[model samples]
Target: MSLMITDECINCDVCEPECPNGAISQGEEIYVIDPNLCTECVGHFDEPQCQQVCPVDCIPLDPGHEESREQLYAKYERIMAVEE
Candidate 1:
């Protein structure tokens, strides 16, 4: 599944840099995670880097965007392809 930043986010700005997919960004209120760009760090790390660095623990898996590990890997690949 993709991840989400809840209202509990403290706006620490830590998670934004940690997201390999550039999915995290400053929203009008709290930071937001774009589900389209989120791959749960499947291609870059063993764990979600945003969740690891967020001090308030606001990052959570988005049930709405659930996907298997293989699907996440494919998403990561597609993202990388576009960047390249």
Candidate 2:
């Protein structure tokens, strides 16, 4: 599943650069994770980079956009394909 930044995000700018899929971006109020591009770092890393570096612990799996590990890898592949 994709990860989301909660309202607790301090905009420390840490998560933005950590996202390998480039899914995290600066929103009007805080950082926003794009579900379409988010694969929880499946194809890129063992763990979600954003979550690893988040100081506020605001990043969490989005239950609303739930998906299995296989599904997340598929999304990662699709995103990589588009980039290539």
Check candidate 2 and list the clashing pairs. none
**What does the lDDT read for residue 26 in candidate 1?**
90
Error of 1 at 69 (Å): 0.5
* Model 2 spans > 4 angstroms off: none
How far in Å is the alpha carbon of 40 misplaced in model 2? 0.4
Instruction: Write model 1 residue lDDT over 1-84, tens digit each, in one string.
Output: 999999988898999999999998999999999999999999899999998988888988999999999999999999999999
The CA lDDT at 11 in model 1 is 90
Worst 10 residues of 2 by lDDT: 14-23
TM-scores of the candidates in the order shown: 0.97, 0.97
Using lDDT, give the best candidate's number. 1
- Supply candidate 1's per-residue lDDT for 7: 90
